[model samples]
Target: MPSVNAPGLKRRKNRDGTERLYWAAPKSALAAGFPNRIVRLHFSAHDPAQHPLIEAACKRLEAEALEWTAGRRETRSAFDGTIASLVRQYQTDMASPYREVKWNTQRTYDQVLGVIEKAFGKRSLAALGISDFRRWYDEAKKPKAPGGSERVRKAHGIISMMRRMFAYGVTAELQECGRLLTILEKARFKQPGRRRQKLESHHVEAFIAKALDAGRQSLALGTALQFETTMRQRDVIGEWEPIPVAESAGGIVLGARRWVRGLTWADISDAFVVMKVTTKTGSEVAHDLTLCPLVMDLLARVPADRRIGPLIVDETAGRPYAEHAYAREWRLVARAAGIPDSVWNMDARAGGISEADDAGADLDAIRSAAGHSQASTTVRYVRGTIGKSRKVAELRKAHRNKS
Candidate 1:
């Protein structure tokens, strides 16, 4: 048997007159028990000269493996048993799951992680108890927004991540350790009141007028287009080049790659207009919207120059506005327009649908325009009767008299 000078490699002779290679962690690495530094290797019984490339490649691989093993061992040993080391490991291993989530979602998790690290930094994971979690939760729940409900949603999001991490630890390395289920149960969030407050047509009109009057033409166009389209804030203001008017059928069409998920530009012909979108629920449907004179006029007002790339861009950055930034600006615009700050900006889309229905648009037509998978979803956006209730009542009365 030959022992290689490479710190982690050991060669052993097999009973069948063959040789095998194994990665033996350094004595310090074995003592520390960090999985990353552990490596193992096996080689087939072949004459080394017959596969000169394979022999050379194996030597190169072994050298690189030894380098990685030593580096990780040294790094882990420096941190010893500190919280910082555990967090670095956890973040490295667990970070991928959060990557594809929306920017707003990632921001929420980051904020939550910060609070958790601040409160529990010195404590060992096994020692975190129900009372410690409760103290954090109680402190988190005290601040209220203007509508007066506690703004502890951020805290709850953090606790949820901690719970997931603890669960992963239990499954991956700590089965014998006591679980944090009891602590997590106490910290779970209760459902707050319905958060989606619909804005009125008057409010929408006022917002546009104020933005336009303030010489904020781009903002006015962005606000109006988003309201009319019912697109997600990100989709509405993303780095998508709008379908050219010559190509579009007198209606706004977005490149399928820009708005729709799970489909590529190559999947459909460039000539195909995007009439439907697949939502997160896996339903494929098109948004229904009327090319109302008002909507047409709003689109017409957008300068051809500003329409060069994305329909909406951040006024300051000249880049696509992230959803949260758009939401914040939406609130500011609503407040400036004399609308209640409590009103949810998302309601503007619903308000537009309702207004169209009031003007005698068909239910099915509205559904198609809004890209709702079900007509019922479109109905939810219909805030009030839209005079349909009165018209139905009048028809019922006339039918009763005729009978």
Candidate 2:
């Protein structure tokens, strides 16, 4: 049993045989101390009745607690409670984004969040204004995904992410009172610069040779596959799904392409040296690509015992390469090959098209094999200046013979 000694103080005896003191602010001062108008004083049985120092210390503690409670601050300052912190919570919130987007899409947004955090992680949301956003927009280099197609820019792509985070802060009351929504409206994104770089002919031999020297067989094989087939990143290593088949006029059978699906080793015929694959263009269109000896040789590197599995593997994981992880592997291999930072899978397709042009393949032949919907699109891939020069010289010879 504990004896009550102090005024305006409540006492409770814990199971541990310790006495606790809590000061409950009266109804008149209900707005002070804590949200519940209660402040924890001390656990020891210190009497303020006789000790003036103890009584003064207790009064000071209560006053400080009340001040803190009035501000409604959980952290030291507004800097700790930031837009970056709010976005992180919104991303992982079980109620919203986690339930809305797929895992891969969520991963993509995480990259966007990372850039946002790096730039403004310490910025107080309450103090962020149009000038701060405009400065960020001018200075922020758009986050380009390692292998993804989306261009992440504060004004263009990442604005959606910014909008969502601010909106979440508002609904959750996590943000300090500010006009964050108004700043977002002022951003304008124009088209970014086009990428004109292409993987050249000599880079092919150098990359494969360097990859082999490093014992990176998976990268070497992945390179040849992308170069030969011109498949998109996911198509190279992604899982395959059975496409639906239907009968057409004259009892012809048509296998409709499923873009979401991918090609596997099971889709390849070693003897025929051809691959049938669902392409990125549409749901029903497919491509039948002729494989060269290089592609066949690369395919042979895979263990013969493997019957059916994802064709492209990380080797480290013994699984299909997640697009992001594979991009890292590609960069390492490219560095070993002495390829510049600008060269990527997009350039690999150009290498294949350039090879065809060097072999004197005409526009129609190149267009059909590359699956370009328009000649203009196919022409954009022609990077061999020597091949074009040779074609011009040959036409001059033919004109002289006609004269």
Candidate 3:
């Protein structure tokens, strides 16, 4: 038998002496979302007759890999009218809702889009029906473990992304997508329950104590800042975004990661007032740290030399923690403080909003404090705690007695 001339081909031998073949894609093929970095060539390894087929398959896959690497996959002849194509169109189309979202939000949408493409990329959009989607939903909603909680949120997110994609297809005048959207409108799915957990003062104190003890002063201060200011975690922790093609003049670049501005010392006035433009709403919000003793005390403890850059710097990286890293570190500290996993770093803002409601602050004031453009948006985060209800009851009784 002669050696085959197929590149990237590997053969593994079994105990029974039969061999299995695989084509390993180059590392760069990851940009194309290549599965497990390899494609199985279903040919008998001992058969010389299979060599030509194996070589052909390898060449074709390699060409596709190169096409993806050059970023020309969308423009290539392979742009069939599949859900995958729709995903590509929805993502790149400037008028699509995907483009309207903030950078952090787009990142999440990309993850769900990847899931869509991987699962249904080859499936024809015209053939899809409510039954197919229901089956997909069932598969997506399954628990990761045998008895673990169902992934209701994950399932809902996938369906939401699919709906958005189909809606975009309708905007683009795709007949199949419009039909799918119409069919989906009548379909029923289980909705995830709204999260009511809020980080309370005790959780904040415990987190701060744990963070400080762990030598994570920045994490401690960041927590206090978010809780006191009622700012989103993204606004407090900041985020790394890709440098756009247009211009690269602004934003701090560390290695390949471009840092969007988070809460910086420059944003804080000498009088301990924070004036910041939030990432989500782009709303400028001002808060007096002097009124928040925890924030002020934490600020005072920071030496002048270290207070020059971003307000919350990861001690380990000497810069802002990536969103995942921040969440992970926060979870560790929160767990150390005996805070339940249900309460998240994001809940700090909710906790602050709820605290404001409990403190007898007007709805308008709470909304303003939250930097929300609408009272309805602020209302979502404000949990009706026992303290707020008790205050309302006391006020009602006092008014009755006076009457």
Candidate 4:
């Protein structure tokens, strides 16, 4: 909030043609706890008109900064403690190496940030107490999800992130911030059930056919690739490209470059090929590309020049397709096919494994295909949602087939 042109400011021009602004707080001012730092001005020193503006900024900083620094850091008022401001301050440290976050985790944080801003962005952090959090939890309704357990979870995450931010504020030596988390104890969270979005093999065939018929060749192929390889959407979403073939010490190297987690076009070019896929749990599975006729056929429909590019791409725009576009395309196809539009393209992978279960594939085989570190996790995917009888029938079919 303090400007570079504040009192006692000095300017320097560097060989790189950019200007720098530096101010030394009088030692007496520093003793009073003024935040002393250098400010690098992005403007060129050659600009003569900026001098007066710079001097005025320094004077204002000199005058206004003393009030904040003259005493101990004071508690921020509620109106001043806007969630947006809190998030900005928190993110300054989060971007620091000591607090770096993963890409996927950062995406979740961004989503939560929007929810917080919508609910209480303008509210002061210090003014909020137990009562306010309770009220937010009871009233939190996501724009798209109005009245479901999912809505409750979204509210829970928003409050949790607020609590996390306050914890960071406390770590930054702001007083009374950590105590505010106690207010969130009344916020209830939903215990989510096992996910049940899956498809049978026949259903997958129908979905792909309809998707292709709808003129979304890339979407159709991408969905089939997920099912055929049982890959997580991240790994399957246009990541696969052609790699140069060559002989290596151990065997054939699949590509000119290697990705520990990425697949190549060559990996799926044949009836069965060895390729490794990694999942969210940080484990990798080698897929022997079999049962992939549908995926291969869809690939053949793509233009030849684009074949070496991503498996799924926005060919009209000459770029990769957005994740939401994949789901939106699937919804269009589903609606046209008379299937539930609630089905997600992500469910195609689950369909592959569940179909494997129905077709009497070994649990370990399914587990390996799905790239789960723990086989028990794969077992959970096969759990029947509605009734035990459904699972019983599948087991009975496997038994009958063996006889």
Candidate 5:
């Protein structure tokens, strides 16, 4: 009776006594070339069974009208059958592995893919060869600015992504991709050495002090949690993802932000242990919080009433921090503590592993604590074999003394 009471929604009654819903695009939308003057909706406004359908249509049309007026086009880039086209294909094709990866990983892949598209998008796959790639590799690894150091890691990432893309092409049974893969197989690229920087105890202490002084308790807790439990920053702070149109269901508007799973208070046990599965490896890890005095102290400071939902909430947003915001805020606190830019928040996991090894903890035990599926993965985070070497030296001296 109230014409569905939504913007751009109206009711039309037929002489046959049937009522149907119609959407009227606003003048602004009309000026922007709206598709039609009045779009008839499939649902009837008078039917209680169809009211939900009418409501959904109304909202969708309203959003469409807004977007049309805002000049936002959802057009796809044309495919020219070049490397850029292939990249787009890999990204959009449902069967492509790129479509199946986690969002964070997709973001990483996009960074490298963007570089590939920009550099060689116009070049035909048949024209690219080992020589072209080798020359590009040399140029990419060079310093971007005068007096700046070379970007070996960044260059290495590009090469690695290219290899994967070519391999993907072979999987898709593209003859050109198969040839490219064969060529790539014969090439060797510069491999950057593993990172040696580990989070030091002083760095942790300073970060905590600085974060607390700035009144960012969540960040202080996050730092201690990451350093002590060997958990990733994403596992602690959570991530923001777009709410799908079909699943938007209310509260958070469609196309806005929604929180993915992260560390929740329910993950903690009565013994002050954090037990949860790692997001990356899907391996369950249990960390005894009582053993980590810093982490425990920070947890204790949180009021009982606030100790609910996500363990780490960005006070500014009253919700979990997005990945970028988390890093930016962490960097600010880190800079205040005089921590160098070379050392990242991610290095905290490595710092914890190094500390555990240095304390003479068993290798297998450390591996389990880090939630690594293989011992080798955990070993990479140990930074150095200083602890193992010290133990070997002590054993040698003892044998000599006995003799």
Candidate 6:
């Protein structure tokens, strides 16, 4: 029998003549030479399970030692040096592209990255498993904003980018590293309820009346023209132009055109208002709008000062308002007008489609006015009118019976 000699150690002989041993070294030995914990076993050559059991036990012991060693090493080299270096390189190289995104979008990415870095800063990217990623993703999905699902989707995008960076690092320098990174599957956050309220025509009229009464005729008319033209606020203020009074039958004619990089406005014959507009769908086509009397009168009242390159100027930047700046101002205007929190500026486009349909406008006309590629795209806007149509049909049937 081979006897155990270490202190605080035990050994027992099994019926098959194999031995199992457990030992605890002195605390001083941990710092001197030996680790605080150790295990050993010996078996006769005839034991069938001995080899497999010993192999598994050896692996477990090696893994524990590796974990302890990782803790004692320098923070930068704790993750085998390669992962740490890759993170530093990615942070350095991402500055320019990150800056090009909108400020709000950049902020969101920054916040998500901060959370992920804080959680796994000391861990090796190659060592990351799917379980760790699930934990992080679940934490990120807790915040419920109006577009919470979209926000969480963007967070997942950031994670995907990080994973790609690590993969690139592995291929470039860690060729000998055999471990595969486990990435979390893409997950979508739950969508919040739609709280959007459609602005009625009467509400639009009231807003116009208030603006005109306040001597802010230009702002009033601009807002009205935006609703009538179904132009986004960015397109409306960025592309305002004056119309010519020539050949005026009843009202002056004005035209605005959106160029490739900029916008232009000109006055043509009173019979036609022509402008080259780049629609949101990326089609560069000329739009011929018939100038209404109200639109012409509104154009005449626009002050000379507001008649810079575009109708709206960024007072802070002293240039044509960028989309972000205009969107901010539009939000303030909507709030001041007592617009419901649920309603957004896009509702105006919906309202315009509804108005055109009520006036018996052709589907093609509605599609052109709304700048949609297909008339089917405009069909969604009139879906609410199905109820009205049913009621009208019932009334017509009753009237026919009485006749």
- Measured by lDDT, the strongest candidate is 3
* Between candidates 2 and 4, the TM-score winner: 4
TM-score of each: 0.57, 0.49, 0.76, 0.61, 0.77, 0.48
Ranking by TM-score: 5, 3, 4, 1, 2, 6
What 10-residue stretch in candidate 6 is worst by lDDT?
A: 251-260
Show pairs that collide, candidate 5: none
Summarize candidate 3's per-residue lDDT along 1-403 as a digit string, tens digits.
3677777787778799877777776778675664336655666666778778778767766776676777765542332457887888888877788887877788889999999999988887867899999999999999999999999899988999999999997786543676789888888899898779999999999889999999999889999988998999888878888776786646667665688768888988988888888877888888999999889889989889877878888899887886589999989999999999989988999999999888878889888878999999988888856656887799999999999
lDDT values, one for every candidate: 0.55, 0.61, 0.82, 0.62, 0.82, 0.52
Write model 5 residue lDDT over 18-67, tens digit each, in one string: 87667787999889876545755655565777776667766776777788
Question: Higher-TM-score candidate among 1 and 2?
Answer: 1
- Model 3 — which ten-residue stretch has the worst lDDT? 72-81
1-403 per-residue lDDT for model 6 (tens digits) = 3332224444567799766654343454355433425443333324655545444444544454455545543232212333444455444443335535544455666675665566565675445555666666666555576644535664465566565555554443332122333233243334344333555566566656665665555445556656676665545555322233453332211233121223333322345463436435654434344544445666666665555454433556555554455556555555667776666666765776777777667778778876778888877776345444756788999999999
Report the C-alpha lDDT of model 4 over 1-403, residue by residue, as the tens digit. 2333446677676699665665455666567655434332333344666666566556654554566566545353211335676676666554332257654477778788777877688786556777777777667634454553446566667677877877776565333355565455444555335678785567677878887776677667767778877787767763322243563423222234222333446555455564654647667666654557886677666666654644566545444554366666677777776666556667777777777776667788788778887788887777343334556788899999999
* Candidate 6 or 1, higher TM-score: 1
Candidate 1 TM-score over all chains jointly:
0.57
- The regions of model 4 sitting more than 4 angstroms off are 1-85, 94-99, 102-108, 121-129, 142-150, 166-174, 181-187, 191-194, 239-263, 266-271, 274-282, 296-307, 358-365, 374-380, 383-403
Q: Please name the candidate that would achieve the greatest TM-score relative to the true structure.
A: 5
Better of 3 and 4 by TM-score: 3
What's the best-to-worst order under lDDT? Answer: 3, 5, 4, 2, 1, 6
The C-alpha local distance difference test score for the whole of candidate 5 amounts to 0.82
Q: What is model 3's C-alpha RMSD?
A: 14.3
Q: Kindly list the per-residue Cα lDDT of model 1 for residues 119-178, writing each as its tens digit.
A: 666675545567777776777777765567685665566567776656554443331112
RMSD of 1: 13.0
Off by over 4 Å in 2: 1-190, 239-260, 273-279, 283-291, 384-386, 400-403
Name model 6 segments beyond 4 Å from true.
Answer: 1-134, 143-195, 214-218, 239-264, 267-276, 285-288, 291-294, 303-308, 313-336, 354-368, 373-403
